[model samples]
Structures are given as structure tokens and as C-alpha cells.
Target chain A: MSQLTPVATTWVNGQVADNLPVTDRGLAYGDGLFETLRASHGSLPLLSLHLERLQRGCSALRIPFQGERIEAELNMAASVVGDGVVKLVLTRGSGQRGYAMPVDAVPTRILAISPLPVYPADRRDGIRLYSCATRLSDQPLLAGIKHLNRLDQVLARSEWQDPAFAEGLVCDQQGQVIECTMSNLFARVDGQWVTPDLGRCGVQGVMREYLLARLVERGEPAAVSRLGLGALHEADQVLCCNSLIGVWPVVRLGDRVWQVGDETRLLQSLAEQVYQ
Target chain B: MSQLTPVATTWVNGQVADNLPVTDRGLAYGDGLFETLRASHGSLPLLSLHLERLQRGCSALRIPFQGERIEAELNMAASVVGDGVVKLVLTRGSGQRGYAMPVDAVPTRILAISPLPVYPADRRDGIRLYSCATRLSDQPLLAGIKHLNRLDQVLARSEWQDPAFAEGLVCDQQGQVIECTMSNLFARVDGQWVTPDLGRCGVQGVMREYLLARLVERGEPAAVSRLGLGALHEADQVLCCNSLIGVWPVVRLGDRVWQVGDETRLLQSLAEQVYQ
Candidate 1:
């Protein structure tokens, strides 16, 4: 449903520069961080959360943090459309062909406004999953932070084109379930809502973190735990959550099918209150 | 040493273009392949080898191949610099913000030439190595080919900045020594040269492959074998090779030191024949 719309913006520090330079490290080495935010009725729900995560990611990557400029840019992006998705990309500016960071490099920022993708009405009606062959690397240093090195996700996502499969579950080299390609996986087991710990592999999704806090506030126990294939197979209820896609229940994983449980629906409703 | 001499000419779709759209998948997800070649007297010594490797990388990533245009672009790039280094970057062009490849994508091709980096004369005299804690993932699908998703190498390289430590050796999850950040490792053990197998991790450097073939032709037994830390420490001689560096002897890895031996010097002489 994405039609060509007149999306306009401005870039700083260059002439005729509404675009990033070809020599940007983001393009060269994928040296960048991005935040995809949804704005409804000219206001972003949990905007602070998105900005905090972005700032944290920038700090972790040693990218210069420009909070004031980013807030102004976000406002400008939202002004064009009353409601939509705004993507803010911050790159380590231009550099010569090498991995060493320039001593006096200025960071580049890009802001793009686009219509939020429309999801299927039954997207929450228990989706299907494929166990992706692509395994996430167990890199504690790069894990948890949302960096631009996403080849693993791209490869895993390319494995299937069938609309029937909503997402894919990826594990680490040790066969420990990490998370989905683009979302954080959560499962209800032994009367607790649990998600995989991203200390070893996977991104610490903003929505996943928010859900964990919400569950705690409501006196519902939730935890971040190490998970394995056996845990996934024995999970009473399964769901995937991302900032864009609030919560999606999984009805089947491979040949095993699951029913949409009460906890899954409860989490979906809670996220809808914030996302919708 | 990189002065603004405008060292190279780049052509896109048979026209001179320098800037790519920010939406390019290479910038978005690093969905691209690159080749760094050594050019001398307006000709690339292993041009066919580099092109074949690039084609193989494209085939592995499912990226479209445009060899004719790439050849023409390389010729133009070489014409600008009689002796230099030529870098050819092929990206999956612009796409919507997603991992899925655009159904009809015309890949972006970038060709640039620059002066060869000056290596220290004493670099031939064994260099120090650091065993980095950054472990490479055992992903065979993306292994061997030099793609843009190199955060692992970037992280490993950033671990040290000591001039004495010329290179860092990375290992896979199974504690198998893979390769250096930008080069391939070879060790002379039992009077035979052996390099780590790249079937699971590490990039297959063109120069390393060339040397392997040359060693085989000379009746000097060579092998692609799985290497361990113990084997590396007990090796008779250690060397690292790449297209740019040619061959560099390893004098020390942590506390263990290796003396420059005849086998390493012979390999260096063989590589220098082509490099110089």
C-alpha cells in the first residue's frame, strides 16, 4: 500500500545536500544506527523511549550523539505527515577507504518519512514460523545493540517468500534460540512470560523491553532467559514482538501448531494501547 | 599519504556518477560485494581472478552480475592511474527500507582507483600478532566471499592499535583459528604450508589462493586444514598474506615469538615477484 508520495526533507553541512555522500561509512562498512518510529496524530507515543534507545546505540558504537538536532529533525519529519513512520539514520559521515575512523569526522544524519506498512487483519491470529538455517553469531560486544551489520537478518529473511509464514526463528551456533530475524520472540512457559536473553545474540528490541516493564508493572512476572530448541518446542504459547509490529502470535512452528492463548492476547492488547 | 589527487574515474551505467541514493541496500543492509586489486603499469595482474571472485560472490548473494559494464568501468579506472589500487564495489542498489530485495533491482557499480598504501619496509621483518577475543561465526553460507558485512573484523581490528602488533588473529566459535582481520594466515609446519580452511569462516583472499596454487605447482605441499591455537603456537613459521600486503611474517603472537625462517622468506619472495 506504499504509493509514491511527495516526501521532502533537508540535510545539513553541504550544498544541494538532501542526500548522504557516496563515501559515507554507513554505505562502506555499515557504520550507522537507525530508529524507525511511528507517529500518530502528529505525536509519537513513547518517543522518549525510541530516542533513548537511539542515544544508547550511538553511545555504544562511539557515534557522536546530537540529541537536539535529532529532535528537531523528528519534528520536521512529522510535520510533513500527520501520521506515519519516520526513519532517522545517523552515519559516521564520509571517510576514505579504510576501517580507521577519521580524527575529525563529522557524523551524517538522514531523516526519511514514509507511510507505515499496513499489516494483515489476522496478523495477531497466531502466525506461522520457519526455523531459519541462518544462525546469529554469539557476539556479546555487538549483541543487544542495534547496529547496521544485518547481513544475517537479510539472509534469513530471504529464505522464504510465502505470506503464510509471518516470521522465522534464528538460533546461535550452539543451537540456542536467540530471536526472530526482525522481532523479539516471547513465550509463556511455567506461568511466566519469558523472552530470550540478547546478551549473546540478537537485538534488544525496544518493544520487547517495554513489554517486560509493562508486565512487571502489572504484577505479571516476566523474565529474560536463555532458551533452547527444547524450550521453544515445549512453550505453551509463542509470540513475536517488534516496535513496528506490536505483537504477533505464532500458531505453528514447523509441524507443531499452537493456539492463541490468553497471555498472548493480553500482551497484544497492552501493546496496541501504546502502538495504535 | 592520500592526497586529493583525484586518483580514479568511476562510471555507473556507462556514465560518470559518484553519489548513490541513501536508500541503496548497500547503505541499508550492506548487501554488496567488493574487490580490492593491485594495479601496475595500467594493468591488473589478477584482474580475471578478482572478477571471477566478484561474480562468485554475487552468485552466492543472489545479486545480479553485470560483468561487461564492470570490465568497461575497470578499464576507465585504470586509465586514470598507471599504477595504483583499484576498488570495485557492486551493491544491490536502492530499495525500500526492508531486508527483502526489490524484485527488479539494477545493482549499483562503483569503481575507484587510489595510490597504493605505503607499507613499512621493516614490515617484511616479522610482525607481532594479537589473538583477539572476537570470535567469527560459523556461517558457511556467507563464508569465504568478501561481502560488506564486516563488523566482526571491524570489532576485532579495533581491539588493538599498537604499532608493534601489526595484525590480529580471529577464531571461530569452535576455537579454530580463522584468519587475520584483513588477511589470510598461513603456517609452515612439518615443512609444508597450511592455511586455515575458509569453508566455515573467514574470507578467501585471492592472493592466498594464488599462492596455494603456486606452491602446489612447485611441488611444495600445501593444504587447507583446520587450525587450532596450539598448532599456531607450535608452528615452525607463521605468515599472513593478502592482495595488498602480499606476505608479512609473524614474529610474535602474544608471548610466543617465531623467528623468520627460510620457508616464510621463500613465500615472501614468491609473492613479491607479483606485488612489485
Candidate 2:
């Protein structure tokens, strides 16, 4: 673990610990939801957006939402995290040996700050993506929410260790493109920016939602729909977006290569202005 | 959370700590494997079996499994427990942001002992089961292994709050009976013991494997195959098995009552002899 540094600092519940308790439901059963935010100059770019998604996930998981308490903690962590990543983990707290949840559950809130990842400038120009063999399982109940059950992502990410492959685009069981391993995907098809629907599977990305809302507010031709894997190849350009890494254009996916297109450039520039 | 009593003692990475490091991957991404073993009289009844399964899970997840190191720690933990449940959690230790695993990954070993849960005497005779609305997603890669991704089970168990319903029988998206929330399921159909295949979803319980093996050795008629939801209702008897709950005859599943059969009695007696 020496090659990569962990959290710069961490707060468990409200205080620092040697680590979290071994019995924490998050660690025990992956019973939790998390948000990874981009922090710059001691400020979170999309803090509220991330919190909104987390709130939705908490509500879906039936965990009591303490929005004000979370925001207070977020502000404290954001102050120290200047130009880094702030990861917030909310777990169903500790539990006994059974799968049944406790009645009076005190949700454990974990906030951690890590140094910002430095990627090559060329990556923003375009990144090669691997078509992962690990397909996203369809489960409407867990779909769209960034829950802790991320083994599918782990397996998909592990498909290729080659740094040449910056990321992996995965599909559902029926060959429908869901999303990339880490980011939400968008492809310009028939002169419209179309993104995969996260109704059955995939994380309802914060950046994806932000851009969709932005597109709608600005009256841009874009859609969130079921996209087949073949549709991606037929599309004019493919773009991946996430809060951590604003937007990445897909230059190549295996043999299919895409030049930095007009629409992709427009979105990329918009990302920079939005970040600013 | 306060109502549920935590482990009697815990060992994190060979040393006792106030809690686990907040950055551990198990808590962060649910990148871990765990085993809940039955320890009695300062000894684990299924220590080797649990280790075998954990090793398989580690191999599948590409995490280096340290068998001797884990065994040493388990023995040390088991010695102090006397009689209870021993939970061993192995995680791909702390790392920087991103799903790409660290090169110098040091797997964290957590050993915890919790008091044995006291089940009702009538549970052995038969238990009522709730047919959960939460259907298990089909993910062949994660099937059968007791990895930390258990939100499906958590959701299924949460379907019913009534204490009268001891467990819930969950089906996959294909309407095939998978397993109980925390235990493996079996039914005597056509006078033969059969279990739902774990090829798609569901944890392969240690007790279930043990009984299957015992049946094979004794020349008993038992097989693991596809079991649809309708098959459970048409079965002669239903049984639930887990390391913690040895063997529970499931007499009722949502008004579909079943009488205790010869196969269920034989299995119960065998479980007692095995535990002895």
C-alpha cells in the first residue's frame, strides 16, 4: 500500500479513530452509500449535488437522513481538503450477527480527505476504454444509487491492469451499454447527446445528472435512455463524465477510434467553465 | 446500534485497536471476504471449512490469501471466545482514491468474537418464512461466495419486521428460489433432498455444504439444481441451514404450511450428532 497514500485524515462518526469498529455494518455487509467529491481551493465544486444523491440513497436504504448534520461535517472536512478529494461514507452502523437491521440504528458517518489524483494532460484529450467482460447485473431496487455493493465495479476494473486502458465501459446482461467503470457515459447519436438510463443498473452519477439538468435548462438535444452497445459504435462521439474527473472524451475503445469531435470539445470547454 | 451488543473482543491486523482504520477498503468499497464460524469450547467446529471458502473467495477476487497467518490469528481468537461466533474479515487494505488496486497491497485481517445467538426451541421444529419482495440479482461472478456485498440480503430481511417470521426466502430475478436471507435453502421434493443451485446468486452456507457432503457419503438421495418458486410449495418439506443456525425445518412460508417429514427429522438428528 506504500505506492498509494490513503486518506490524508479521517473522521469516524465525529472523531478520528485508529480505524472504524470491526463490527461496522459498512465493513461487515457493505451496508452503506458513499460520495466522492472534487475539492479545489478549500471548496467543494458540487458539494450540494453530491449530498442530494447521498440523501436519496439514504432514503432508499431507509436510513434516517440528517442532512444538516452531514452538511456541517462536510464543511469542516472541505476546509482542510483544499484541492483534493473528499469521500463521505454513511453506514447503517454496527449490528449483531444477523442480517436483520437494528430498530434504533445510529448511522455512522465517515468523512475522509485524500490528495487529488494527477492524470496526464493527454487523458483529458481522450482516454482509451476497455470493454469489460463483467456485465452489470440488473436490479432496479439498487440501481442509480451509489451503494457500497461495488464488487461488480471492482471486477470490471480488474479486467485489465494495463495503464494503456484508462477505464472500462460495461454493459448490462442484455448487451445494453450501462456506464463506464467509474464515470457515466454519453454518446452523440443521430446528432443528439444520448446517455444510458440507470433505471435497472449503473450509478446515477452526480456529474451526469448535473449535465443532464444543464442540458435541459439550456434546451440542448440530449437524452437519458436505454442504449445498446452497438449504438455507442454508431454514435458520432462518446464522452464520459464524473464529479472527480469532469469530462473525458473517448478517443478509442479497442479498435473503434473517435477523433475529438465538435460536440465533445463543446462539452469539455463547458466542463472547464463549470469547474471554474 | 446500541441495542446490538458488539463483539466480545476484536483483533485488527494482529493488534488490538479502538477501531479499524477509516480508510480500509472493506468499509470504503466492500472489497473484502468474511466468514462467520461456530466456535464452541474454545474451538471452531468448521474452522478449516471456513478457511477453504475464504481462500476460494480471495482467489476469485485476486486478493492474496495468507492461510497460515489467518489460521494463527483464528486460533488465538477462538481460544478466548470459548463459545460463540467468530467472524474473520479479510480486506484489501488502505489505498489511494480509485478502484485500481494498489501494488503493495497489505490485506487487513480482522478477527472478532460475538456471543452465540440463542434461537427459540421451536425454531428447530419449524420456522415461518417471509417471501421477500427484494429479489436477488443474478451475478454469476459473485454467486456462492460469502463476500461482503450483502445489501440484497439486508433489503430482503428488512422486508418483514415481524419477529414471528424468522427468515425470508428470496428468489432471483428469474423467479428461481435462491436462498433465505442468511441461510441456504433445501427441500425434500419427490422424497429426495434438493437445494437451490447457487450458480446465479445466494451464499453457499457452510452448513449446507457440510450436509450435502454428508448425504453424498451416506448414499442419500440429494442434489443441487434449479428450484423455482412454485417448487417450494409443492415440496414435501423445506429446511434452512447456516453455521449459526444449524438446521431449521421451515414448516411455513406465507401460509403454505408443511408438516415435519422423515428427511427433515433425519437431518436434524444428523446435525445434533455433528455438532456433538
Identify the leading candidate in terms of DockQ. Answer: 2
Which residue pairs show collisions in model 2? Answer: A1-B104, A19-B20, A19-B21, A20-B20
Q: For model 2, how does the per-residue alpha-carbon lDDT over A133-242 read when each residue is reduced to its tens digit?
A: 99997788899999998989988998998889878999997889999999999999998999998988899998888888878877895888989878899888999999
Q: For model 2, what is the error of residue A220's alpha carbon versus the real structure, in angstroms, after optimal superposition?
A: 2.3
The per-residue C-alpha lDDT of model 2 at residue B170 equals 93
Q: Candidate 2, which CAPRI tier?
A: medium
**Model 1 stretches astray by more than 4 angstroms:** A1-18, B1-8
Residue B131 miss distance in model 2 (angstroms): 0.9
lDDT of 2 at A224: 84
Interface RMSD of each: 1.8, 1.2
* Per-residue C-alpha lDDT of model 1 across residues A115-229, encoded as one tens digit per residue: 8888788987878998899888666767887777778888888888888888888998788988998899998888888898888778888889889999989998688888888
User: On residues B1-276, what C-alpha lDDT tens digit does candidate 2 reach at each position?
Assistant: 121123447777877643777778888789999988887787887778888899889987889999998987787677777787778889988877678777888999887887889888899889999889899987888888889888998899999988799989999998889899989999988878889999878888888888888899999858899998788899989999888888899989877999988788888777666556
Relative to the true structure, candidate 2 reaches a TM of 0.95
Whole-model lDDT, candidate 1? Answer: 0.81
* Tens digits of lDDT, candidate 1, B3-66: 2134335444445566777778887788898888887777777778788888889988889888
